[model samples]
Target: MKVAALLIADPEGPDPCRLVHGAPLLRHAVAGLLASGCADRLVVAVPKSALGDCEVIIRAVPGAGSRCRVLACGADRAESARLALDAAGESADVVLVHDVARPFVPPATVRAVAEAVLAGAEAIVPVLPVTDTVKLVSGGVIESTSDRDRLRVVQTPVGYRPDVLGKVCARGSDPLSDLPGSVRTVAGHPTALRLTTAFDVAVAEALLEEQG
Candidate 1:
Protein backbone atom coordinates (compact mmCIF):
# COMPACT_ATOMS: atom_id res chain seq x y z
CA MET A 1 0.00 0.00 0.00
CA LYS A 2 1.21 3.51 -0.73
CA VAL A 3 1.56 5.39 2.54
CA ALA A 4 2.91 8.85 3.27
CA ALA A 5 3.88 10.60 6.52
CA LEU A 6 3.79 14.31 7.34
CA LEU A 7 5.95 15.62 10.18
CA ILE A 8 4.83 19.07 11.28
CA ALA A 9 7.55 21.51 12.32
CA ASP A 10 6.50 24.96 13.28
CA PRO A 11 8.96 27.70 12.32
CA GLU A 12 8.61 29.61 15.61
CA GLY A 13 8.12 28.47 19.17
CA PRO A 14 9.13 29.08 22.77
CA ASP A 15 10.76 25.68 22.55
CA PRO A 16 11.53 25.75 18.87
CA CYS A 17 12.03 22.35 17.22
CA ARG A 18 15.70 22.70 16.64
CA LEU A 19 18.80 20.50 16.88
CA VAL A 20 19.24 17.99 19.64
CA HIS A 21 22.46 16.05 19.88
CA GLY A 22 23.72 17.54 16.63
CA ALA A 23 20.56 16.67 14.65
CA PRO A 24 17.38 18.64 14.16
CA LEU A 25 14.24 17.26 15.81
CA LEU A 26 12.72 16.94 12.33
CA ARG A 27 15.57 14.62 11.37
CA HIS A 28 14.90 12.43 14.39
CA ALA A 29 11.23 12.33 13.49
CA VAL A 30 12.08 11.36 9.90
CA ALA A 31 14.55 8.68 10.95
CA GLY A 32 11.92 6.95 13.07
CA LEU A 33 9.41 6.94 10.21
CA LEU A 34 12.01 5.87 7.68
CA ALA A 35 13.22 3.11 9.96
CA SER A 36 9.67 1.87 10.34
CA GLY A 37 9.29 1.41 6.58
CA CYS A 38 5.66 2.38 7.07
CA ALA A 39 5.54 5.47 4.88
CA ASP A 40 6.56 5.33 1.21
CA ARG A 41 7.09 9.09 1.24
CA LEU A 42 7.77 11.57 4.05
CA VAL A 43 7.02 15.27 4.10
CA VAL A 44 8.33 17.74 6.66
CA ALA A 45 6.63 21.10 6.97
CA VAL A 46 8.35 24.24 8.23
CA PRO A 47 7.52 27.91 7.76
CA LYS A 48 7.84 28.95 4.10
CA SER A 49 10.70 31.16 5.19
CA ALA A 50 12.53 28.22 6.75
CA LEU A 51 12.27 25.88 3.76
CA GLY A 52 15.88 26.42 2.82
CA ASP A 53 17.14 25.70 6.33
CA CYS A 54 14.90 22.62 6.50
CA GLU A 55 16.34 21.37 3.19
CA VAL A 56 19.83 21.69 4.58
CA ILE A 57 18.84 19.66 7.62
CA ILE A 58 17.15 16.96 5.51
CA ARG A 59 20.25 16.60 3.39
CA ALA A 60 22.39 15.87 6.40
CA VAL A 61 20.48 12.71 7.21
CA PRO A 62 22.08 9.92 5.13
CA GLY A 63 19.22 8.32 3.18
CA ALA A 64 16.56 10.89 4.10
CA GLY A 65 17.61 13.18 1.24
CA SER A 66 15.87 10.85 -1.21
CA ARG A 67 12.76 9.81 0.73
CA CYS A 68 11.85 13.15 2.29
CA ARG A 69 11.08 16.64 1.06
CA VAL A 70 10.27 19.96 2.78
CA LEU A 71 7.00 21.88 2.58
CA ALA A 72 5.99 25.35 3.71
CA CYS A 73 3.95 25.09 6.91
CA GLY A 74 0.91 27.30 7.29
CA ALA A 75 -0.02 29.84 9.96
CA ASP A 76 -1.58 27.27 12.24
CA ARG A 77 -1.42 23.52 12.84
CA ALA A 78 -4.55 22.93 10.79
CA GLU A 79 -3.27 24.91 7.84
CA SER A 80 0.11 23.25 8.12
CA ALA A 81 -1.56 19.87 7.85
CA ARG A 82 -3.48 21.02 4.82
CA LEU A 83 -0.31 22.24 3.21
CA ALA A 84 1.35 18.89 3.79
CA LEU A 85 -1.61 16.94 2.43
CA ASP A 86 -1.54 19.02 -0.71
CA ALA A 87 2.16 18.43 -1.22
CA ALA A 88 1.82 14.70 -0.52
CA GLY A 89 -0.33 14.34 -3.65
CA GLU A 90 -3.39 12.07 -3.88
CA SER A 91 -1.65 8.78 -4.48
CA ALA A 92 -1.21 7.72 -0.86
CA ASP A 93 -3.61 5.12 0.42
CA VAL A 94 -2.92 6.17 4.01
CA VAL A 95 -1.40 9.27 5.55
CA LEU A 96 0.18 9.65 8.97
CA VAL A 97 0.47 13.06 10.62
CA HIS A 98 3.13 13.42 13.26
CA ASP A 99 4.10 16.32 15.52
CA VAL A 100 7.67 17.48 15.21
CA ALA A 101 7.63 18.03 18.95
CA ARG A 102 7.05 14.32 19.52
CA PRO A 103 10.38 13.21 18.12
CA PHE A 104 10.92 9.81 19.71
CA VAL A 105 7.90 7.72 18.79
CA PRO A 106 8.84 4.08 18.40
CA PRO A 107 8.78 2.56 14.93
CA ALA A 108 6.58 -0.22 16.31
CA THR A 109 3.86 2.34 17.05
CA VAL A 110 4.11 3.74 13.54
CA ARG A 111 3.76 0.28 11.97
CA ALA A 112 0.91 -0.60 14.28
CA VAL A 113 -1.02 2.50 13.26
CA ALA A 114 -0.46 1.81 9.56
CA GLU A 115 -1.54 -1.80 9.93
CA ALA A 116 -4.67 -0.75 11.79
CA VAL A 117 -5.54 1.72 9.04
CA LEU A 118 -5.06 -0.98 6.42
CA ALA A 119 -7.27 -3.29 8.44
CA GLY A 120 -10.23 -0.95 8.00
CA ALA A 121 -9.74 1.85 10.48
CA GLU A 122 -10.68 5.30 9.17
CA ALA A 123 -8.90 7.37 11.83
CA ILE A 124 -6.46 5.99 14.35
CA VAL A 125 -4.81 7.74 17.28
CA PRO A 126 -2.42 5.97 19.59
CA VAL A 127 -3.17 6.77 23.22
CA LEU A 128 -1.73 6.19 26.63
CA PRO A 129 -4.45 5.77 29.20
CA VAL A 130 -4.45 8.47 31.87
CA THR A 131 -3.20 7.11 35.14
CA ASP A 132 -3.18 10.26 37.18
CA THR A 133 -6.05 11.64 39.13
CA VAL A 134 -7.89 14.13 36.98
CA LYS A 135 -9.77 17.19 38.06
CA LEU A 136 -11.85 20.00 36.65
CA VAL A 137 -11.42 23.42 38.17
CA SER A 138 -12.63 26.93 37.49
CA GLY A 139 -11.40 30.11 39.16
CA GLY A 140 -9.49 28.11 41.75
CA VAL A 141 -12.68 26.24 42.58
CA ILE A 142 -12.81 22.47 42.09
CA GLU A 143 -15.65 21.67 39.71
CA SER A 144 -15.48 17.89 39.60
CA THR A 145 -13.14 14.99 39.30
CA SER A 146 -12.78 13.34 35.92
CA ASP A 147 -12.78 9.62 35.36
CA ARG A 148 -9.19 8.73 34.79
CA ASP A 149 -10.18 5.44 33.23
CA ARG A 150 -12.07 7.32 30.55
CA LEU A 151 -9.27 9.72 29.77
CA ARG A 152 -6.55 9.10 27.23
CA VAL A 153 -3.39 11.08 26.55
CA VAL A 154 -3.26 11.10 22.76
CA GLN A 155 0.02 10.75 20.91
CA THR A 156 1.10 11.32 17.32
CA PRO A 157 1.68 9.50 14.03
CA VAL A 158 -2.13 9.74 13.94
CA GLY A 159 -3.20 7.73 10.88
CA TYR A 160 -6.04 8.13 8.45
CA ARG A 161 -7.23 6.83 5.11
CA PRO A 162 -6.06 9.40 2.61
CA ASP A 163 -9.60 10.15 1.41
CA VAL A 164 -10.83 10.66 4.95
CA LEU A 165 -7.88 12.85 5.80
CA GLY A 166 -8.25 14.81 2.57
CA LYS A 167 -11.86 15.59 3.33
CA VAL A 168 -10.97 16.79 6.81
CA CYS A 169 -8.06 18.83 5.50
CA ALA A 170 -10.33 20.44 2.95
CA ARG A 171 -12.22 22.13 5.76
CA GLY A 172 -9.05 24.16 6.27
CA SER A 173 -9.82 24.56 9.96
CA ASP A 174 -8.26 23.05 13.04
CA PRO A 175 -8.78 19.34 12.41
CA LEU A 176 -8.19 18.58 16.06
CA SER A 177 -11.21 20.69 16.96
CA ASP A 178 -13.23 20.39 13.72
CA LEU A 179 -12.96 16.78 12.59
CA PRO A 180 -15.65 14.23 13.29
CA GLY A 181 -15.40 12.61 16.71
CA SER A 182 -14.92 8.96 15.76
CA VAL A 183 -11.43 7.68 16.62
CA ARG A 184 -9.68 4.33 17.07
CA THR A 185 -7.00 3.56 19.57
CA VAL A 186 -3.68 1.72 19.59
CA ALA A 187 -1.45 1.44 22.65
CA GLY A 188 1.24 4.08 22.94
CA HIS A 189 4.70 3.92 24.53
CA PRO A 190 6.11 6.35 27.05
CA THR A 191 8.93 7.14 24.68
CA ALA A 192 6.41 8.86 22.44
CA LEU A 193 5.89 11.75 24.87
CA ARG A 194 5.89 15.17 23.20
CA LEU A 195 8.46 17.87 23.91
CA THR A 196 6.60 20.88 25.20
CA THR A 197 8.94 22.37 27.79
CA ALA A 198 12.63 22.41 28.54
CA PHE A 199 12.04 19.59 30.99
CA ASP A 200 10.71 17.49 28.15
CA VAL A 201 13.90 18.07 26.21
CA ALA A 202 15.96 17.06 29.19
CA VAL A 203 13.96 13.89 29.61
CA ALA A 204 14.30 13.06 25.96
CA GLU A 205 18.02 13.59 26.13
CA ALA A 206 18.31 11.22 29.05
CA LEU A 207 16.09 8.68 27.30
CA LEU A 208 18.21 8.85 24.18
CA GLU A 209 21.32 8.20 26.19
CA GLU A 210 19.75 5.14 27.74
CA GLN A 211 18.57 3.86 24.37
CA GLY A 212 22.08 4.15 23.03
Candidate 2:
Protein backbone atom coordinates (compact mmCIF):
# COMPACT_ATOMS: atom_id res chain seq x y z
CA MET A 1 0.00 0.00 0.00
CA LYS A 2 1.22 3.45 -0.86
CA VAL A 3 0.99 5.80 2.10
CA ALA A 4 1.43 9.56 2.20
CA ALA A 5 2.05 11.74 5.25
CA LEU A 6 0.76 15.30 5.62
CA LEU A 7 2.18 17.83 8.07
CA ILE A 8 0.94 21.34 8.77
CA ALA A 9 3.81 23.55 9.86
CA ASP A 10 1.74 26.48 11.02
CA PRO A 11 4.03 29.33 12.01
CA GLU A 12 1.35 31.07 14.05
CA GLY A 13 1.57 28.42 16.70
CA PRO A 14 4.45 27.76 19.12
CA ASP A 15 6.89 27.93 16.20
CA PRO A 16 7.35 24.49 14.79
CA CYS A 17 10.61 25.67 13.25
CA ARG A 18 11.99 26.35 16.71
CA LEU A 19 15.09 24.33 17.48
CA VAL A 20 14.61 21.14 19.48
CA HIS A 21 17.50 18.86 20.25
CA GLY A 22 19.68 20.86 17.86
CA ALA A 23 17.28 20.57 14.94
CA PRO A 24 14.08 22.35 13.88
CA LEU A 25 10.95 20.63 15.19
CA LEU A 26 9.61 20.48 11.66
CA ARG A 27 12.78 18.71 10.58
CA HIS A 28 12.33 16.13 13.32
CA ALA A 29 8.74 15.48 12.22
CA VAL A 30 9.79 15.06 8.61
CA ALA A 31 12.72 12.89 9.53
CA GLY A 32 10.67 10.68 11.83
CA LEU A 33 8.02 10.06 9.18
CA LEU A 34 10.66 9.29 6.62
CA ALA A 35 12.43 6.99 9.02
CA SER A 36 9.18 5.10 9.53
CA GLY A 37 9.40 3.88 5.96
CA CYS A 38 5.60 3.80 5.88
CA ALA A 39 5.01 6.86 3.78
CA ASP A 40 5.76 6.63 0.09
CA ARG A 41 5.32 10.40 -0.19
CA LEU A 42 5.14 13.40 2.13
CA VAL A 43 3.37 16.72 1.63
CA VAL A 44 4.04 19.53 4.07
CA ALA A 45 1.72 22.52 4.28
CA VAL A 46 3.32 25.72 5.44
CA PRO A 47 2.33 29.36 5.49
CA LYS A 48 2.96 31.10 2.18
CA SER A 49 5.54 33.44 3.72
CA ALA A 50 7.54 30.53 5.10
CA LEU A 51 7.30 28.24 2.07
CA GLY A 52 10.91 28.68 1.00
CA ASP A 53 12.29 28.19 4.50
CA CYS A 54 10.10 25.17 5.11
CA GLU A 55 11.16 23.65 1.81
CA VAL A 56 14.79 24.18 2.62
CA ILE A 57 14.40 22.62 6.04
CA ILE A 58 12.64 19.55 4.65
CA ARG A 59 15.19 19.10 1.90
CA ALA A 60 17.94 19.22 4.47
CA VAL A 61 16.74 15.92 5.90
CA PRO A 62 18.96 13.08 4.68
CA GLY A 63 16.42 11.19 2.57
CA ALA A 64 13.63 13.74 2.03
CA GLY A 65 14.80 15.39 -1.17
CA SER A 66 13.13 12.95 -3.52
CA ARG A 67 10.05 11.98 -1.52
CA CYS A 68 9.02 15.23 0.12
CA ARG A 69 6.99 18.08 -1.32
CA VAL A 70 6.51 21.42 0.41
CA LEU A 71 3.67 23.75 -0.52
CA ALA A 72 1.85 26.85 0.68
CA CYS A 73 -1.11 26.00 2.93
CA GLY A 74 -4.62 27.36 3.22
CA ALA A 75 -6.09 29.75 5.79
CA ASP A 76 -6.98 27.18 8.45
CA ARG A 77 -5.87 23.72 9.53
CA ALA A 78 -8.82 22.01 7.86
CA GLU A 79 -8.10 23.72 4.61
CA SER A 80 -4.43 23.01 4.92
CA ALA A 81 -5.19 19.35 5.50
CA ARG A 82 -7.52 19.29 2.50
CA LEU A 83 -4.92 20.87 0.27
CA ALA A 84 -2.25 18.52 1.50
CA LEU A 85 -4.53 15.55 0.92
CA ASP A 86 -5.13 16.76 -2.61
CA ALA A 87 -1.41 17.09 -3.00
CA ALA A 88 -1.07 13.47 -1.92
CA GLY A 89 -3.15 12.75 -5.04
CA GLU A 90 -4.69 9.59 -6.43
CA SER A 91 -1.58 7.50 -6.22
CA ALA A 92 -1.49 7.40 -2.45
CA ASP A 93 -3.83 4.77 -1.05
CA VAL A 94 -3.46 5.81 2.58
CA VAL A 95 -2.91 9.21 4.16
CA LEU A 96 -1.71 10.18 7.61
CA VAL A 97 -2.54 13.61 8.97
CA HIS A 98 0.06 14.58 11.54
CA ASP A 99 0.74 17.59 13.72
CA VAL A 100 4.16 19.13 13.20
CA ALA A 101 4.19 20.13 16.86
CA ARG A 102 4.50 16.46 17.81
CA PRO A 103 7.99 16.12 16.42
CA PHE A 104 9.20 13.19 18.45
CA VAL A 105 6.51 10.74 17.33
CA PRO A 106 8.04 7.28 17.40
CA PRO A 107 8.66 5.70 14.02
CA ALA A 108 7.17 2.46 15.32
CA THR A 109 3.92 4.28 16.12
CA VAL A 110 3.90 5.69 12.64
CA ARG A 111 4.37 2.25 11.16
CA ALA A 112 1.68 0.82 13.42
CA VAL A 113 -0.96 3.34 12.30
CA ALA A 114 -0.04 2.80 8.67
CA GLU A 115 0.02 -0.94 9.06
CA ALA A 116 -3.46 -0.89 10.60
CA VAL A 117 -4.80 1.09 7.67
CA LEU A 118 -3.06 -1.30 5.27
CA ALA A 119 -4.51 -4.24 7.14
CA GLY A 120 -8.12 -3.12 6.38
CA ALA A 121 -8.81 -0.62 9.15
CA GLU A 122 -10.53 2.34 7.56
CA ALA A 123 -9.22 4.93 9.99
CA ILE A 124 -6.70 4.72 12.85
CA VAL A 125 -5.30 7.06 15.48
CA PRO A 126 -2.52 6.55 17.99
CA VAL A 127 -3.77 7.19 21.50
CA LEU A 128 -2.46 7.01 25.05
CA PRO A 129 -4.63 6.18 28.04
CA VAL A 130 -5.49 9.31 29.97
CA THR A 131 -3.87 9.15 33.37
CA ASP A 132 -5.07 12.42 34.83
CA THR A 133 -8.29 13.06 36.62
CA VAL A 134 -10.85 14.54 34.23
CA LYS A 135 -13.09 17.42 35.05
CA LEU A 136 -15.86 19.41 33.41
CA VAL A 137 -16.06 23.02 34.53
CA SER A 138 -18.21 25.90 33.57
CA GLY A 139 -17.95 29.47 34.86
CA GLY A 140 -15.04 28.29 37.03
CA VAL A 141 -17.37 25.85 38.77
CA ILE A 142 -16.79 22.14 38.66
CA GLU A 143 -19.61 20.50 36.71
CA SER A 144 -18.71 16.85 36.41
CA THR A 145 -15.87 14.42 36.31
CA SER A 146 -15.07 12.19 33.40
CA ASP A 147 -14.07 8.57 33.68
CA ARG A 148 -10.36 8.43 33.00
CA ASP A 149 -10.48 4.75 32.23
CA ARG A 150 -12.81 5.43 29.28
CA LEU A 151 -10.83 8.47 28.13
CA ARG A 152 -7.86 8.43 25.81
CA VAL A 153 -5.61 11.23 24.77
CA VAL A 154 -5.54 11.35 21.00
CA GLN A 155 -2.27 11.73 19.14
CA THR A 156 -0.94 11.76 15.65
CA PRO A 157 -0.28 10.76 12.94
CA VAL A 158 -3.92 9.81 12.26
CA GLY A 159 -4.24 7.29 9.47
CA TYR A 160 -7.04 7.02 6.93
CA ARG A 161 -7.90 5.71 3.53
CA PRO A 162 -7.47 8.57 1.07
CA ASP A 163 -11.07 8.42 -0.13
CA VAL A 164 -12.49 8.39 3.39
CA LEU A 165 -10.35 11.31 4.41
CA GLY A 166 -11.21 13.22 1.26
CA LYS A 167 -14.89 12.92 1.98
CA VAL A 168 -14.49 14.15 5.52
CA CYS A 169 -12.42 17.07 4.36
CA ALA A 170 -14.93 18.00 1.69
CA ARG A 171 -17.75 18.20 4.21
CA GLY A 172 -15.64 20.09 6.70
CA SER A 173 -16.46 17.36 9.19
CA ASP A 174 -14.60 16.21 12.25
CA PRO A 175 -12.07 13.67 11.10
CA LEU A 176 -12.18 11.71 14.33
CA SER A 177 -15.92 11.39 14.84
CA ASP A 178 -17.46 12.14 11.47
CA LEU A 179 -15.26 9.76 9.58
CA PRO A 180 -17.37 7.35 7.48
CA GLY A 181 -15.73 4.22 8.80
CA SER A 182 -14.80 2.87 12.19
CA VAL A 183 -11.84 4.51 13.89
CA ARG A 184 -9.38 2.28 15.71
CA THR A 185 -6.52 3.02 18.03
CA VAL A 186 -2.92 1.89 18.34
CA ALA A 187 -0.57 2.36 21.29
CA GLY A 188 1.10 5.77 21.28
CA HIS A 189 4.48 6.54 22.76
CA PRO A 190 5.09 9.24 25.34
CA THR A 191 7.79 10.62 23.05
CA ALA A 192 4.95 11.74 20.77
CA LEU A 193 4.19 14.60 23.18
CA ARG A 194 3.12 17.78 21.41
CA LEU A 195 5.17 20.95 21.85
CA THR A 196 2.62 23.69 22.33
CA THR A 197 4.37 25.81 24.93
CA ALA A 198 7.73 26.58 26.48
CA PHE A 199 7.13 23.87 29.07
CA ASP A 200 6.58 21.35 26.28
CA VAL A 201 9.79 22.46 24.62
CA ALA A 202 11.65 21.98 27.85
CA VAL A 203 10.17 18.53 28.26
CA ALA A 204 11.07 17.58 24.69
CA GLU A 205 14.65 18.76 25.21
CA ALA A 206 14.87 16.64 28.35
CA LEU A 207 13.48 13.68 26.47
CA LEU A 208 16.12 14.13 23.78
CA GLU A 209 18.85 14.30 26.38
CA GLU A 210 17.63 11.13 28.01
CA GLN A 211 17.47 9.31 24.66
CA GLY A 212 21.04 10.29 23.92
Candidate 3:
Protein backbone atom coordinates (compact mmCIF):
# COMPACT_ATOMS: atom_id res chain seq x y z
CA MET A 1 0.00 0.00 0.00
CA LYS A 2 1.36 3.38 -0.98
CA VAL A 3 0.63 5.70 1.93
CA ALA A 4 1.35 9.42 2.07
CA ALA A 5 1.52 11.65 5.15
CA LEU A 6 0.55 15.31 4.85
CA LEU A 7 2.47 17.25 7.49
CA ILE A 8 0.81 20.58 8.31
CA ALA A 9 3.06 23.28 9.73
CA ASP A 10 2.21 26.54 11.46
CA PRO A 11 2.48 29.56 9.16
CA GLU A 12 3.78 32.02 11.73
CA GLY A 13 6.15 29.78 13.58
CA PRO A 14 8.99 30.14 16.08
CA ASP A 15 6.20 30.20 18.65
CA PRO A 16 3.78 27.35 19.22
CA CYS A 17 5.92 24.79 17.47
CA ARG A 18 9.06 26.86 17.47
CA LEU A 19 12.62 25.70 18.01
CA VAL A 20 12.08 23.07 20.64
CA HIS A 21 15.42 21.49 21.54
CA GLY A 22 16.98 23.48 18.70
CA ALA A 23 14.69 21.98 16.06
CA PRO A 24 11.44 23.31 14.63
CA LEU A 25 8.34 21.28 15.40
CA LEU A 26 7.75 20.69 11.70
CA ARG A 27 11.28 19.29 11.28
CA HIS A 28 10.80 16.99 14.25
CA ALA A 29 7.56 15.72 12.75
CA VAL A 30 9.29 14.98 9.42
CA ALA A 31 12.01 13.03 11.20
CA GLY A 32 9.48 11.03 13.18
CA LEU A 33 7.43 10.17 10.08
CA LEU A 34 10.53 9.16 8.13
CA ALA A 35 11.75 6.99 11.00
CA SER A 36 8.37 5.24 11.00
CA GLY A 37 9.07 4.03 7.45
CA CYS A 38 5.29 3.88 6.99
CA ALA A 39 4.65 6.66 4.53
CA ASP A 40 5.81 6.12 0.98
CA ARG A 41 5.54 9.86 0.54
CA LEU A 42 5.83 12.71 3.06
CA VAL A 43 4.36 16.04 1.98
CA VAL A 44 5.13 19.08 4.11
CA ALA A 45 2.43 21.74 3.72
CA VAL A 46 3.48 25.19 4.85
CA PRO A 47 2.52 28.80 4.25
CA LYS A 48 3.30 29.98 0.73
CA SER A 49 5.74 32.52 2.03
CA ALA A 50 7.44 29.96 4.26
CA LEU A 51 7.65 27.15 1.70
CA GLY A 52 11.29 27.80 0.85
CA ASP A 53 12.34 27.75 4.48
CA CYS A 54 10.47 24.49 5.12
CA GLU A 55 11.89 22.95 1.93
CA VAL A 56 15.36 23.83 3.16
CA ILE A 57 14.77 22.19 6.49
CA ILE A 58 13.21 19.08 4.90
CA ARG A 59 16.12 18.70 2.47
CA ALA A 60 18.49 18.80 5.41
CA VAL A 61 16.91 15.64 6.85
CA PRO A 62 18.90 12.54 5.92
CA GLY A 63 16.38 10.64 3.80
CA ALA A 64 13.41 13.01 3.56
CA GLY A 65 14.74 15.30 0.84
CA SER A 66 14.58 12.74 -1.93
CA ARG A 67 11.07 11.39 -1.26
CA CYS A 68 9.17 14.18 0.45
CA ARG A 69 7.31 16.97 -1.38
CA VAL A 70 6.67 20.48 -0.12
CA LEU A 71 3.39 22.32 -0.71
CA ALA A 72 2.26 25.92 -0.30
CA CYS A 73 -0.62 25.95 2.18
CA GLY A 74 -3.64 28.14 2.52
CA ALA A 75 -4.71 30.25 5.48
CA ASP A 76 -6.70 27.62 7.42
CA ARG A 77 -6.61 23.89 8.09
CA ALA A 78 -9.23 22.90 5.55
CA GLU A 79 -7.58 24.91 2.80
CA SER A 80 -4.21 23.48 3.68
CA ALA A 81 -5.65 19.97 3.59
CA ARG A 82 -7.13 20.62 0.19
CA LEU A 83 -3.79 21.79 -1.09
CA ALA A 84 -2.00 18.75 0.26
CA LEU A 85 -4.57 16.40 -1.21
CA ASP A 86 -4.20 18.07 -4.58
CA ALA A 87 -0.45 17.66 -4.52
CA ALA A 88 -0.71 14.03 -3.40
CA GLY A 89 -2.08 13.20 -6.88
CA GLU A 90 -3.79 9.90 -7.70
CA SER A 91 -0.87 7.58 -7.06
CA ALA A 92 -1.11 7.08 -3.31
CA ASP A 93 -3.65 4.52 -2.14
CA VAL A 94 -4.15 6.05 1.29
CA VAL A 95 -3.46 9.56 2.58
CA LEU A 96 -2.75 10.64 6.13
CA VAL A 97 -3.40 14.14 7.39
CA HIS A 98 -1.06 14.86 10.29
CA ASP A 99 -0.60 17.98 12.34
CA VAL A 100 2.99 19.07 12.90
CA ALA A 101 1.99 20.37 16.32
CA ARG A 102 1.72 16.73 17.38
CA PRO A 103 5.37 16.05 16.65
CA PHE A 104 5.98 12.79 18.46
CA VAL A 105 3.59 10.30 16.87
CA PRO A 106 5.11 6.86 17.35
CA PRO A 107 5.93 4.62 14.40
CA ALA A 108 3.69 1.91 15.83
CA THR A 109 0.66 4.20 15.67
CA VAL A 110 1.51 5.10 12.09
CA ARG A 111 1.94 1.46 11.21
CA ALA A 112 -1.38 0.60 12.85
CA VAL A 113 -3.19 3.18 10.75
CA ALA A 114 -1.57 1.86 7.58
CA GLU A 115 -2.46 -1.70 8.53
CA ALA A 116 -6.07 -0.67 9.05
CA VAL A 117 -6.22 0.93 5.63
CA LEU A 118 -4.67 -2.15 4.08
CA ALA A 119 -7.29 -4.24 5.90
CA GLY A 120 -10.02 -2.33 3.98
CA ALA A 121 -11.02 0.25 6.57
CA GLU A 122 -12.12 3.52 4.95
CA ALA A 123 -11.15 6.11 7.54
CA ILE A 124 -8.92 5.46 10.55
CA VAL A 125 -8.35 7.94 13.33
CA PRO A 126 -6.14 7.35 16.35
CA VAL A 127 -7.62 8.54 19.63
CA LEU A 128 -6.81 8.71 23.32
CA PRO A 129 -9.67 8.10 25.75
CA VAL A 130 -10.85 11.16 27.62
CA THR A 131 -9.69 11.09 31.24
CA ASP A 132 -11.19 14.29 32.61
CA THR A 133 -14.87 15.07 32.96
CA VAL A 134 -16.34 16.82 29.92
CA LYS A 135 -19.24 19.22 30.21
CA LEU A 136 -21.29 21.37 27.87
CA VAL A 137 -21.34 24.96 29.02
CA SER A 138 -23.40 27.96 27.86
CA GLY A 139 -21.87 31.39 28.41
CA GLY A 140 -20.07 30.32 31.58
CA VAL A 141 -23.20 28.48 32.81
CA ILE A 142 -22.89 24.74 33.28
CA GLU A 143 -25.27 22.81 31.02
CA SER A 144 -25.00 19.03 30.94
CA THR A 145 -22.10 16.67 31.34
CA SER A 146 -21.07 14.69 28.29
CA ASP A 147 -20.61 10.95 28.48
CA ARG A 148 -16.88 10.42 28.81
CA ASP A 149 -17.02 6.78 27.77
CA ARG A 150 -18.30 7.68 24.30
CA LEU A 151 -15.73 10.40 23.95
CA ARG A 152 -12.39 9.74 22.30
CA VAL A 153 -10.02 12.65 21.93
CA VAL A 154 -8.96 12.53 18.28
CA GLN A 155 -5.34 12.65 17.20
CA THR A 156 -3.71 13.01 13.87
CA PRO A 157 -2.09 11.13 11.25
CA VAL A 158 -5.80 10.47 10.55
CA GLY A 159 -5.84 8.09 7.60
CA TYR A 160 -8.29 7.87 4.71
CA ARG A 161 -8.64 6.37 1.28
CA PRO A 162 -7.27 8.78 -1.28
CA ASP A 163 -10.61 9.21 -3.08
CA VAL A 164 -12.61 9.51 0.13
CA LEU A 165 -10.44 12.24 1.60
CA GLY A 166 -10.28 13.96 -1.77
CA LYS A 167 -14.06 14.09 -1.99
CA VAL A 168 -14.33 15.43 1.54
CA CYS A 169 -11.79 18.10 0.83
CA ALA A 170 -13.55 18.95 -2.43
CA ARG A 171 -16.77 19.56 -0.58
CA GLY A 172 -14.86 21.65 1.93
CA SER A 173 -16.57 19.64 4.64
CA ASP A 174 -15.30 19.81 8.18
CA PRO A 175 -14.10 16.26 8.73
CA LEU A 176 -14.08 16.76 12.47
CA SER A 177 -17.82 17.42 12.39
CA ASP A 178 -19.01 15.90 9.12
CA LEU A 179 -17.02 12.92 7.99
CA PRO A 180 -18.65 11.39 4.90
CA GLY A 181 -18.48 7.74 5.90
CA SER A 182 -17.96 5.46 8.89
CA VAL A 183 -14.71 6.09 10.74
CA ARG A 184 -12.68 3.62 12.78
CA THR A 185 -10.42 4.41 15.72
CA VAL A 186 -7.18 3.01 17.07
CA ALA A 187 -5.61 3.53 20.49
CA GLY A 188 -3.28 6.54 20.68
CA HIS A 189 -0.13 7.06 22.71
CA PRO A 190 0.69 9.95 25.03
CA THR A 191 3.66 10.76 22.83
CA ALA A 192 1.14 11.92 20.20
CA LEU A 193 0.10 14.88 22.36
CA ARG A 194 -0.42 18.04 20.27
CA LEU A 195 1.72 21.05 21.18
CA THR A 196 -0.65 23.98 20.93
CA THR A 197 0.37 26.13 23.88
CA ALA A 198 3.62 26.55 25.77
CA PHE A 199 2.37 24.24 28.51
CA ASP A 200 1.63 21.59 25.92
CA VAL A 201 5.24 21.80 24.72
CA ALA A 202 6.47 21.31 28.27
CA VAL A 203 4.22 18.31 28.70
CA ALA A 204 5.39 16.83 25.37
CA GLU A 205 9.00 17.40 26.39
CA ALA A 206 8.35 15.60 29.67
CA LEU A 207 6.72 12.73 27.81
CA LEU A 208 9.73 12.45 25.50
CA GLU A 209 12.06 12.47 28.51
CA GLU A 210 10.00 9.74 30.13
CA GLN A 211 10.08 7.67 26.96
CA GLY A 212 13.86 8.00 26.85
Per-prediction TM-score, please?
A: 0.92, 0.93, 0.92
Give all candidates' CA lDDT scores.
0.81, 0.85, 0.80
Question: Which structure is stronger by lDDT: 1 or 2?
Answer: 2
Scored by TM-score, the top model is 2
Best by lDDT: 2
lDDT of 2 by residue, 148-185 (tens): 99998888899998888988899876453344657889
Which parts of model 2 are misplaced by more than 4 Å?
174-181
Worst window of 10 by summed lDDT in candidate 2: 173-182
CA displacement after TM-score superposition, residue 152 of candidate 1 (Å)? 0.6
TM-score of 2: 0.93
Model 1, span 64-160: residue lDDT tens: 8667878788888888889888888898888998888887899999999999998999988889999899999999999999999889988888898
- Candidate 3 has what TM-score? 0.92
lDDT of 3 by residue, 55-79 (tens): 8888888888668999887777777
